[model samples]
Target: MVSRPHLPEDRMLVEQLRLQLGNIGSSVIPTILLALLLVWVISNDSNAFAMRAWCGITILFKLYLAWDARRLLASEISPERARRLLRRKMVINAIDGATWGSLAWAALGTTTVAGSVLVVAVLAGVAGSSMSSLAPILPVFIVFGAAELVVLGAKLWLMGDPAYDALAVAAVLYTAALLGQARNASRAARRAIGLRFENLELIERLRVETEHAQAAHRAADEANLAKSRFLAAASHDLRQPIHAQGLFLEVLARSQLSADQHDALANARATWQASAEMLDTLLDFSRIEAGVVEPQMQVFPLQPLLNKIENELAPQADAKGIVYRSRETHAAVRSDPALVALILRNLVSNAIRYTEQGGVLVACRARGEQVLLEVWDTGIGIEPAQHQAIFREFHQLGNAERDRRKGLGLGLAIAQGLARALGQPLSLVSTPGRGSVFRVALPAARAGVVAEGAADAMPGPSRAFDLRVLVIDDDESVRTGMRQLLGAWGCVCDLADSIEEAQALARAHRPALVISDYRLRELRTGAEAIAALRAEYGADLPALLITGDTAPQRLREARATGVPLLHKPVLPSQLHRAMSAVLMGRELDSSFAGLEARRA
Candidate 1:
């Protein structure tokens, strides 16, 4: 029976049944105490000594049952195996009960009326308790109870004296009553055990159901993650040529043309830039949700970031006649300045985008050890119920037709995610007609020159006239496009499809600035290519990496290289700014942690 495979569900029931058996076995220690009482009352004689030996052995057997019951309960004992142990215990109980019956006969000579009564009472108690303990196996209980009664009743009837004669008749009647009590106790015990096992089965069923539900949820999450990864991989490949096309358009812009041709080219550039922005938005959302946005936390003043945001978005605000204002504060904050700027940018942009006529105000104030940075705008305010809905991806207010001009409804969601990543809280307060105030609470840093930037040493627009720039990109069209763009800028340019080819060109020309695409052919990278070129020429090589990759690992790797980066589809102005910064060896945006680290 023990060799049979135990069902997983049955293990709990079996363990509980074993526990019940132990409780029933442990309860019998009181019988040992009762037997001790009998020993104290009986006289010290040869007959008494015989009863003492019998009682001592019986007490030892009862202690053995208690010891064995604990050992079984301590482990996972199968029901079939446990029942076998139960049978062994019942055998011991039968022998113990029979011993009690012989005691009355053993002490017949020395036994007084009171002594015999004590002995009979102890025997009856042990028999009754055993009946309840072994109730599940009625045959065992019958064996134990019958042994006690027949031995004691026969001994009493055989004495054949006047007092003994009446007592023997009473003994028979007493045994009958005790047997009835045992039967009742047995039924009650069986009913209670049945209910306990039923409850255990119900609990087991619920546990299995919960595990299945959890497994399904995990599978669904994994599928979503896979889709995000595929989009990231595809974005890198798509951006390369579009980036080249944008650079080619910049070259065309520098060319002299009629007003009509120039206007047509400008419109084409706008469409290309818009496409790049849309792709970038999707990439940013995926990176943030995938937990790839690692913030470069630093102690930086709020004013510089705020000023840059206002200056950058001023045109958009101006076009709508919405007054965009910034309240300057000399407050320094300990946070990722880039991320904080991103959060505020989203809030201000949303305010301006939703508003038809009213202005927007960005204010920073110190509150205790924290700074409350807020963007308050008199826009088309959100309804109370739709406040939370606005922060969800692709969720918009009043854009039922899904107009692309209003932008994807992911700006607030990205802001919220970035705030949480920075260990700050972002909240919104708004009314239907009043306006909305988007706020971020950040830890304030000690005000000092640590937030200040050093003066740039670059000789402005009047610097050097003769500059050679080397461009290495694996994409042929991008390489051709960059060569044309740089030639149009009146700079000596060297273009190549690989580092080896670029190195061959570098040896002949020894170009001053290196511009390389982040990902190259044969699993090589722009950073690696730049490092090798710099090793041969000069370690202080001014280089910039252009990439369209948005995978978290790849982004971190590019950042680690400490080379300035520009995402693909770079406009002519952005390209020139990055170039000027790289040549002069300082970031144009000095407020960012990247340039500050380079300076340090």
Candidate 2:
């Protein structure tokens, strides 16, 4: 009694049974044809009726097996049912093998040696061909082969001849070889099925992980957008009061005060300046992240920019008792000059802040078609591992205490952002306990493309103006503060809180300059107010837009007006410079050139 195969894997058992049974139908016609051929070859006149009857029985058995296979395959088979079906199939296969084996005895008993040879050949062919379909269940193949070989071997041995006995032994050995091959084929099929299942499991796992990653990415983007909206709202509210205070303080400074009073006033002003600078840094970062900072590319001489940076920042280095020098370069570069200047200014200011004793050098040298603009500083140099970290917003080196005077850690971050926006590469080379060099690679302009001109310098002093100025703002304190500041500067001022009011004032006074807040009451923008005033006075009338909005949409909208925009909490001197630029029809001063660059 041969044991049934123990396939513990339920899926594998079902798959094996399905494969074995599915192939049963194709073998039916071939089996019937082979059986008829065998009868023709073995039948004599005396054995003709018996051979024909055996052929009919074999044909009936093949048709029955094929019908049974179709019944099993037509429905979904469970593992337990497959096991039971496997047992029945083994018994059926044994009957099939034995039926073919019966031909062996019938052929040898009545026919010649050629008939026996033909029967043996047919048996060997059937046994070998059945392995592919039956071998998945090793026990079925074993029993099937055993039953056929047992019958043929018994018939051969009972012939009472040495040649027949040897043939019986050969048949037994051949059956063993077929069984061994069947075991290997079963294992190969099992391995292939198992690998297929494992791959499906791995693919499912990857699909789940990918969905989780995509969900996380979308969540992060929404959170970032929310943060930007909150920052813009808070900054605008904060700037209103701060802007009012700065103007009031400037007006207060021009008054006569005792020595101690003057000292206290100066301290208060310095504190206000620090807060304003921090807000400005945040504004710069917000604008870059909002994708609102547009670069105005142009070809310009490098010497004037270098000279300007030295003139502007050398004092800070001098205050620290550290020498500041910028090497003159006639090499011209094609880039956004204002943005490039901002990048260099940040680098120079950062260098000046860090260096305690040695000088900071601003140098530029040509390398092929590019110019390497370098800021060399003899400061507390950075470690190699932290080179990339320093460019991240608010990431500081050696400023663990976050000293406000050392400056917010956004300078380098802003520089890197602006450099990327301009498509220039900014890189750093540093060694711990030594100096560091920050280099910007700018594309050099073609020869004769750069036209040299005197750079726009900040106005020398606050010049008194006899012109009439229209100031529009919804905030009352802001209006009062502006009125006081402009009155001190000898300007006739007309203030309004709405566009209708501003137009009414412009009609009465016909102001020379129109200064308006970007956001006003009744959902009116200062750009609209400025346009109304320009319509009243003339299109050529000078106009300036002041806003504290850090929101990307508002920033972009304000910039599209082609008007000079200044952020709130503006220093008195910055306000003076902007007014002078708008009056003279020259470029606005560097104080708000970043905003002016947006319009360009």
Candidate 3:
């Protein structure tokens, strides 16, 4: 056993007394019975009184040992008082051993042979039981056992018989055995205590680690929530000015201008459009992550989807001197078409962006009940190691200079996310310097499955802009910008800041269509104003509500009103198209209806 000097002296002594407490009752009972037996077996001679007196003293000493063991068990066992307890218990046990040794002297004075043997055997029994009781405190048990055994040997030597001498030698061997047993038990007790302390330390460590992990998890969740709130607030505030600017820019585009100013304004508009597209792309990604883009899964033709991607990305490919091809197929698939289109668009855009000389191809092949749509590019083929890494956000290849024209390295990542959300298989196959093929497998539509069509959000026929429009916005800048743009489009505009003002304006000169900011004065929403105006004017009064909030809950609340929702900064053209639709008593196109899903 390993020596544990680090074990406190008082702790060891206290624990030993505790063990003695349990053994006290049993140990005392057997010894008491033996005392009575010894008295009965002794001779009734003159020395008989002496023997009985000694027995009485021995029984009294044994009782005192019992009392001490019980006291130690019941007491608080403070360290300062422990030394006194240790001495008291050891002294009592030692005196009891001497009392028991006197039994050998009493047994020798016995008249009959059986009486002497019985008395000696009783003393031997007492020594063995004492060994067990004092096992935790070996030094004390050793002292008592030695005293009893040595006195027995001395008393036996005086008996003068050779056989009696041999019995004395046997007593010596028994004492050695008792001492050995005490040592082994003490070692075992200390080892058990060591293990207990070790276990406690280990348990404490695990508890600390678990607490740290929980705290870190909570911090991360709080940080993510904070980030979402900030983005939502910033998106709203930033878009208000941007929306007003876009309207003013459109008004500027309509007026007569010199050739130089026209070219400059055209460049400015192009730049603005690019920035807006990036914002929309980022917002779309955020919406999907926020669980706001609940896909309306259905069967849609692969050909129409491919043609859309081709038409959208062809101009970019042509500008890059790359041939773009999409093979027509009646292959239909069961999935969300918008999400699928989004996935394909990113893939095609990435393919064109990466390729310098070669062309891009879009084709579908049957794979059992599914169709694998592949976007192949002859540009720079990806390395085998980078095939998976390329799909991670902000990871790029061969663009160490960080060119903006090549995009922000989110195309493949968004594509990967969308494909995973749709539960479709998207894989990449490539060999460096040859080509790369991005493949996605969609469930093939059954023979009788009818695909759903969507209403396009595209603007049509701007000549029908002679309707009376009411614009409600808390911001003066937004109201002025709206007035200028609508006036340029030849529409009469009435403006207000609150629902009451809007109502009064409408009552005086009723608006043919209502245009309002989503968040109006006094914490009232545009949906409420639109409803109040329709109630006062007519049930068929057309209305449009615009918001700049990207918060998922805000978007969901806006959609809950069954109004076609548009996020700011809304381009003037988009507002015009929505006005044209709403004035005709129609919501946005079927396509945007699913995309926006707020149209009643």
TM-score of each: 0.71, 0.81, 0.78
**Model 1 regions more than 4 Å off:** 1-118, 128-143, 154-221, 283-341, 352-371, 376-403, 417-424, 430-436, 442-465, 587-600
Tens digits of lDDT, candidate 2, 216-271: 99998898788788888988998998899999999989999999999999998888
- The alpha-carbon deviation from the true structure for residue 305 of candidate 3, after best TM-score superposition, in angstroms, is 1.9
**Mind giving the per-residue lDDT tens digits that candidate 1 earns over 1-600?**
534223343443454456445665656667587667677777467666776787797788767767776776777677667556556756765775677677777766567777767666666666656656655545556667667777777787788776766766666676567667656765565555666666676689888988888898898778766756776688888888789888888778878899999999989977887787777766667667657567766788888777877876877899999899999888888887767877887788888899878799999988999999999989878898998888887788889998998888878998898898898999999988878999999999875645344221122342322689999988889989988877777788889889999899999998889999989989999999999999999888788888878776677677778778877766556677677777877754311323212111
Question: On a 0 to 1 TM-score scale, where does candidate 1 land against the true structure?
Answer: 0.71
**Candidate 2 C-alpha RMSD relative to the actual structure:** 5.3
The local lDDT score (0 to 100) that residue 288 gets in candidate 2 is: 83
Tell me the lDDT of model 3 at 208: 96
User: Each prediction's Cα lDDT score?
Assistant: 0.74, 0.84, 0.78
After superposition, the stretches of candidate 3 with alpha carbons farther than 4 Å from their true spots are: 1-137, 147-161, 314-328, 350-363, 374-413, 425-439, 448-463, 488-490, 507-512, 521-524, 528-541, 580-600
- Higher-TM-score candidate of 1 and 3: 3
Candidate 3 C-alpha lDDT tens digits along 103-157: 7787675657777778778778878878877777787788789778878889999
Rank the models by lDDT, top first.
2, 3, 1
Give the range where candidate 2 is weakest over 10 consecutive residues by summed lDDT.
Answer: 591-600
TM-score of 2: 0.81
Off by over 4 Å in 2: 1-8, 11-92, 95-115, 154-165, 297-304, 311-334, 352-359, 398-403, 444-456, 460-470, 489-513, 520-524, 528-542, 580-600
Model 3 TM-score is 0.78
